[model samples]
Target: MEAPPVTSMPVTGGAVNMMEYLLQGSVLDQALESLLHRLRGLSDNMDPETFTDHELVYLLKGQQGNPFILRARRSLSHPTSPWHLRYLGQPEVGDKSRHALVRNCVDVAASHSLPEFLNEMGFRMDHEFTANGHIFRKGVMKIVVSKLSRILVPGNTENTERLSLSYLVELSVLAPAGQDTVSEDMRSFAEQLKPLVHLEKIDPSKQRH
Candidate 1:
């Protein structure tokens, strides 16, 4: 089935300058259960929503070393939601705080034919993967426990293999620019997950080196 045409909505409060609060760490195979238990208690509701997503990361190479990244994702479980296209700009340098990294982000909603649209826009498929996870929400914060798998074949969502035994844990909150209080809330929630997984904001630039 073909989806509708792409549409964009104007975000309020200067979304272009929005700072994302994020904490990322890995959970060992043995500690997965303990982490889940702790999450269940901290989350608003008892049951967590499960989701499987197939994501394609596209890049436009430039003369400089840095490349522009565009991510397109579709939900495997919910067919109703439109495909999402997201661009998260390179993180700013010199800020090593665990609170969060500030970056420019643009999000667009498009039909399933987004791949063709991306190619038309000069983006090449760099890599693709599948992530299965459980999402827990607390106020404005979103916590996800995800396991990534490598896509065995391009454009074939079904063909995949587990990338690793450890699960990737992420804590993030998307808020309008200038909302400094969100960072403190994110840090407090992160502390609750302590020894099971140490969640800290990782520098994307440093990770590349």
Candidate 2:
């Protein structure tokens, strides 16, 4: 199903930065080609244990460069965003009011199905990147490019002929809520899990039926 606009607040954008242009022209332009190349290299060069979280974060941040993602903003970490956006299967934690509003928004949305859902028709996801605590600056959307079967692309990369995890990391350009960006993933993830997943105050496994 077609999703609704993330927020009702009007959007306004500012000027661009030198760094934004660098990422857009370089990595963003060759996202697909780069992704495919990296995927091809995985067989010989991939290392599971050596790969670290910072490296993963670096990979995620460095990879977005497709024409479509660039259309969302002049560049990643641009001075401003196009508008508010959302994603499925992210995590959320916050005040009751904000959490409730976000939770409700995701209720009508579908999960971001990737490689597993290749043959099956369903909803797709775009995880737009900006910044978070200690990560991004204000109003600057940092480009986080992920490979197939990874965080942005979730599934097994070894045997799948179809690279269904191939997609851009869709980010929210502008959001009305102050400090709201921090909770985007958590809120989105909780919203997705609201229907099928359950959470308990204490450990549920310790309880008796």
Candidate 3:
């Protein structure tokens, strides 16, 4: 069976439920600098946060339903920081009234033993990659601009090749389940990035052939 639903996993010790509102787009390598400059001015005043992370996708197969998937990510630049484990459900794209795609999301901070723990729980590694990016925040909204690299040798994060000549951009906010207002904020922020990058609620499920 799948591990557990977001509501069951108490990452935050409360009765409230959380959901992830997301918008995604991409910027060509040449346009990255300008986008970064714009984001720096628009985002929070703290120093820019840049990161290098190695991420592994793990899957646990079941007799019925889609395979349970989990992402295990650890920072290469800040090795001392805790690893991040995230579970994101399928995006809800049918609601045209909403400005952003909403999905169930559970985030947990884990120790370096994350991989071993997942394996012990019968999860298999599906793929791995390295992401180098800058993170920005405006209120509860979080934005990430990242370039992905395909790991060449298994388990070797150092030996990787660029996946594309563009950087993937994501604007997201984790808020309580009923907060539709957060999508308005996301849409407004996306407008600020207009022409530079067109962020939209692209359904990943539809893209799968």
Candidate 2 lDDT over 108-197, as tens digits, reads 111232222322432232432222111121233322333322233332222223224333222222332354543454344333323322
TM-score of 1: 0.85
- Ten consecutive residues with minimal summed lDDT in candidate 3? 1-10
- Give the alpha-carbon lDDT of every model: 0.79, 0.26, 0.91
The TM-scores, one per candidate, come to: 0.85, 0.20, 0.92
How many collisions per candidate? 0, 19, 0
lDDT of 3 by residue, 126-171 (tens): 9999999999999999999999999999999889999999999999
Which candidate would rank higher by TM-score, 2 or 3?
A: 3
Clashing residue pairs for model 3: none
Over 101-196, each residue of candidate 1 has an lDDT whose tens digit, in order, gives 545566778898899998998999999999998888998898999999999877787889999999999888876656757878888888888878
- Model 2, stretches more than 4 Å misplaced? 1-139, 149-157, 162-171, 177-209
Candidate 2, position 80, lDDT: 40
* lDDT ranking, best first: 3, 1, 2
**Model 1 misplaced stretches (Cα beyond 4 Å):** 1-16, 62-65, 96-98
